[model samples]
Target: MSSRLSSRRTRAGAVLSAALVLGSMLVGTALSTQASAAPAPDVGIAATTFADEFNGPAGTPVDGSKWNHEIGDNVNNHERQYSTNRTSNASLDGQGNLVITARRENPGNYNCWYGRCEYTSARLNTIGKFSQTYGRFETRLKMSHGQGMWPAFWMMGTTGGTWPNNGEIDIMENVGFEPNTVHGTIHGPGYSGSGGIGAAYTGPRFADGFHTFTLDWSPNLLIWYVDGQEYQRRTPADLGGRTWVFNDRPFFIILNLAVGGYWPGDPNASTPFPNNLTVDYVRVTNTPGGGGGGGGQITGLAGKCVDVAGASNANGTPVQIYDCNGSNAQRWTRSGNQLQALGKCLDAAGGGTANGTLVQLWDCNGSGAQQWAISGANDIVNIQANKCLDVTGNNSANGTRLQIWECTGGANQKWNAAV
Candidate 1:
C-alpha cells in the first residue's frame, strides 16, 4: 500500500505495548515445549505447485533459483530499513525455517541515498523465477514484534507495469503497532496505495507462534484466511470506478521484514533490536476449488445487459435490464453457486419461490436464495425458486426491473454471456 498514515499516529503508543508483550510471550514459548495456540498452514502436499520448507543448514542463503532479493532503502512505503542480500538478514535457521532478521546497523555497512540508515532487513521476491495466474498462496510464519517492525506476505504483477496499474495483492501485512491484526488488500489504478481496497483480521498475537496467512485467488475474486479461517474477500466491484487488472495475469510473491516507515512510524528507544520474522514455510497450489470463472458482461432479454441499477454497490441494489455499457456495474463473476455483481449476489428478493419475485442484489452467502444455474434453454434460472430471470412485464426498455418468473420460453427468459 501507500506510505501515508495520519490516523495511525495516535495508535503508536498502543503498538509499543503490544510489541513488548508479544516479544515476551514469544520468547517464553520458544524456551518451552508447551503447545502454541497459533496454527500452521494446511498445505495439501498432493496439490502443491511450489513449496519451500527452508530446510537447509543454519545461515545458508536462500535458493537463488526460487527468489531474488530486493535491495534498497525506504522502497515504496517510506520504510526506514535497507533491504540487503546478506545471509545475516535472510537465511535458513537450521530448524526448518527461513529467518529474516532486522537489526540496527550503521550507514557505513550499506549505502543509502536517504542519508544515514540505522536499520537493515531483508526483502525477497519471486518476480522472474516464479509467477502464477490463479490459485492458493500461503505461508506459515511468526511475525516480528517491535514498535517499527513491518512484515508482509504479498504479491505483485510480473508484467513490468507500473505500480497500481500492474496490481498488488497484499495477502497479509502487519505493522508492529498492530501485532494482533493482519490486513489483506488489493491495489490497482484508482484504488491503490493507502487507498487500496481491503480489510483487517484481529485475534491472537501471531508473534507468539506460527500462524498461516493464505489467499485463495481466482480470476475474479480474492479470499483471505488466517490459519484457515476466512476473514475477508475482495472483488472488482469493491474498487468502484477502478479497473480490475488481476484477471488471467501472472503475479509473483514477496516476503519482507521492514523497520520503521510512515505507516508504523520510526523506531523509538523502547524498540527492540534484532527483531526477526521467522517463516516456517511458503507454499503455492493450483487447485481452484471455490468456483473459478472469468469476470465479464452478462446479457439476457433482447441482448440487454444484466446491470446494477445506478451502478450502486449497496445491498438491495436493483438488478435491472439496461443497454450494455460495459461498466463495472454490468461486470459479473460466478463464485460457487452465486452470480455476483458489485460484490453482491443476485437474489430472488425475500427468497420468493413464486413467479413475479423481484431479483435484487444481496450479500453473498451459500443460501439457496443466491444459487443459480443456466438451463438447457439458455435461461438464467434461480435454482431455489425454479424460475427464470426475466424482464418485468417483458419490457426491454432500459431501467426495467428484472424478476423471477415461471419458465415460459419467452425471449426475456433467455440469457447469454459475452464473457
Candidate 2:
C-alpha cells in the first residue's frame, strides 16, 4: 500500500487569490428545472438517517446545509488541478444530479507543478455540518472519462488528531487510468497513504453508467460493496498491529474531482477537456442489526446483560454476565460480524477455535475468531470456532465471564440482542 501514496500533501488554499479572479466574473445563473423524486434504498436495511437525492431543480447550487466547498489548489497528492469554489466546477445538472466537472482551462495565475495550472475542479465535504459514528454510507455516481481525472467519495474522522491519526475511509476512489476498477481503503496512524489497508473491485467500466459504492462500518469492521455486492472487508486484525481508531469517533463525507495527482499521473493530450463526475445521490443509514450512534443492550440467560468487564476501553477486556442495568458498558452495537461495547469490539481471545475459548472485548481487527453469526435458533455462534456464546455454567450468576462452547438448545445459550 505504501507504494501508492503521494509524496506531497496537497494543501487547498495556496492559489486561492489567483483562482478567485477567474471565478469572480463567472457567476452563472441556476437552471430552473423540475424537481425529481428521491430513489428508494436497498431492501431490509435500517431507515435512512440522512440523504441527498440531488432531485432539486437543475442548475442550482448544492444545499449549503449539507456541504461546504473545499477550494484552492495549495497542495496534496501532487495533483495539477486548481480547486475552486465556482458553480461551473460543481453544480446541479438540470436532470437530478450533482456534477463536479474537471476542466482543462487555466484559472488565473495558479500554477501546477509543470507550469501554469492546466486544470480546474472542485471538492466538497460535510465537515462541521454532519457526521455519523457507525452506519451504512453510500453514494451513486458515474466516473468522469479522461486520463488524469480522479474522482472519489470518501470520509475522514471528525475527531481531532492528524490525517492518519484521525483515520480516513475511502469509500470509493477511481482514476481514469483504472477505469474499470475502484478502490476502498482505511488509513490510520501506522497504515496511511500508500500503507493504507484496503482492496480494489474490478468489473465493467464505472464510467459506463451510474453505480453505487457502499461502506458498512461498525465497531471494528468496514465492509465495502459495489452495487450491493460486497467485495472487501477489513478490521483491526488487518491493521498489522496498528491501533483501531474508527470506533472512537464520528466521520464526515467528502466528494471531489481531481486532476493530475501522483496516483493518476498528469493528464495527456489525449485526455478530454471538461469531464464530469456525475452523482445521483448519497445516503446514510443505521444497519438493521447494528445500533450505531444510538446503541442498545443484549438480554440473555435469566435476562442478565452482556456487559463489558469494568467498562474498560482497553483491548482484551473481559465480557461478562451481570444483572440487567442499562449503562453504556452494556450497550451493544452490531455491524457486519462485529459486536461492540464501550468503544471496543467483542472478540474471541487469541483467535482460538477451541471450545472454552473466552469471549472478551478487544480493539477491532479483522480476525475470524471475532466473527459471529446468529443462528435460526437464536444461538450466537462464533464462525471461526463454530462455538456458541455460552455462560460458564448453567448458573445465572453475576460476574460470570462468557465463553464459547458446543451449541446446545440450552436456556443459557439463548440471547435477545437488541441490535
Candidate 3:
C-alpha cells in the first residue's frame, strides 16, 4: 500500500530529468546495485500522490493542525532543551531553508518522565501529520557540531503506536563531533541502529555545508544517496518486519535535534550548545506508470475490451499484459466475480499458498479458483495465487516472461489495473 516516489515536472518541450531507478546508478566500480526496483508511481492512488512543502509560496503550508510538533522529550539523544519557535532556536529562511539552532540555556522545560531541558535549541517532527505512501523525499540542509549534538530528519510508522514495530527511516542523521560523515538507516523489528541495517555516505562534512539527501522507495527494495551518489542497497530481509508493516500502513515525517539518547551519548562541557540544522526545502514528485509494470497501449482487442487490461492471448500462455483496443481479444465478460477471457478461468498455479506461485488459466470451476480483486487503484490479485497478475517486473520489454510467484510488493504487482 505504501511506496517511495521520485519524479519532476517540466514545461512543454523541456527535457525533464528522468528518475534514476532503483538499479539505475552504479556506485564505486559498478553501474548499479541489485536492490529491487520500487513500484513505479501509481498516481491513481490518492495516498501515493504529490506533496507541497510547509507554508511556502510553492503551495499550502502543511496545515499545522495535521502535524504535531514534538518538543521537551529527551527522546534518545541527551543534548539540551526543545523549542519550536524560529526565535533563538529554529526558523524558516524565506529563501527555502529550515534552521534549527542549539544553544546553551537554562534548563527551562521539564517533565519528570525524561528530565528537563538545560540548554535551549530547536527540533521539529512530522510524527502526527503528513507521510506519503511512496515518493522521493529530499532535503537540502546544513548541520551543527559538538559531541552531544544529534540532529536528524526521519520518518516513523503512524500505526502500531511503537518504534521498530512501526518502522523508522533516518534519511539524515549526524553528531556534533563527527562533523564529516553522515548516515542513513532503517530500524524495525529485525534491525536497529548499530546491530540494525544501516549505512552511511561520506560527503563533505555535512556539519559545515548543505547537501541533499534522498531515498528512492520502490516495491522491490530501498536505495539511498547523498547528492546523487549511490550509497546503499537493501532487500526485504534487511528491511525486517517493517517491510510488510511499512507497506501496509501510512507513515509520517519528523525533523528533530535530540540532545542525547541511545546512539550518540550524553553531551560534555566541550560540546558546543548553539549549533544548527538548516534545511533549504523539501520537494516531492510522483512517478507516472503505476509502480512495477512497464507501460503499453491497448493493442488487439474486441469492441473496447472491459475488465481486461493485462490478459493473455494464445491458449495455454501464462497471463500477460496486453493493450486494450475494444476488441474481442482484450474484452472479457464479467459474471459477478468471474472474469472470462479466452474461455479459460484464472487460477493459481498448483493452488499453492507459498510465495511466488505461478498463475495460470484453466477451465473455470466456479469455486474460489476464479475469483479476483484489486486493492490500490492499480494492484490486482487472484483469489487463489494471492499473487498478482504482474507484467514481469514491469519491464515494458515486449515478450517479457510472465511467471507467478508469491507477492513481494514490487512494481510488477501493480498492473495498468483499471480497478
Model 1, span 275-369: residue lDDT tens: 99999778787744323322467788678999988988655678888999877688775443456665456887767676666778765444577
Stretches of model 1 off by over 4 angstroms after superposition: 4-45, 289-419
Q: Could you tell me which residue pairs clash in candidate 1? A: 2-193
lDDT per residue, candidate 2, 97-166, as tens digits? Answer: 8999888887577776667887889888988788899888877788997788888899888776667677
**Residue 62 miss distance in model 1 (angstroms):** 0.7
Greater lDDT among 1 and 3 belongs to 1
lDDT of each: 0.72, 0.72, 0.50
Q: Which of the two candidates, 2 or 3, achieves a greater lDDT against the reference?
A: 2
Clashes of 1: 1
For each candidate in turn, give its C-alpha RMSD to the true structure in angstroms: 17.5, 19.5, 18.9
TM-score of each: 0.60, 0.61, 0.52
Model 2 segments more than 4 A misplaced = 1-3, 7-46, 112-115, 288-419
| Clash count for each candidate, listed in order shown | 1, 13, 57
Question: Per-residue lDDT tens digits of candidate 3, residues 130-226?
Answer: 5666555655567777787787777776776455567677787886667788777776664544545678766577776556566656654566656
Worst 10 residues of 2 by lDDT: 14-23
What TM value does model 3 have?
0.52
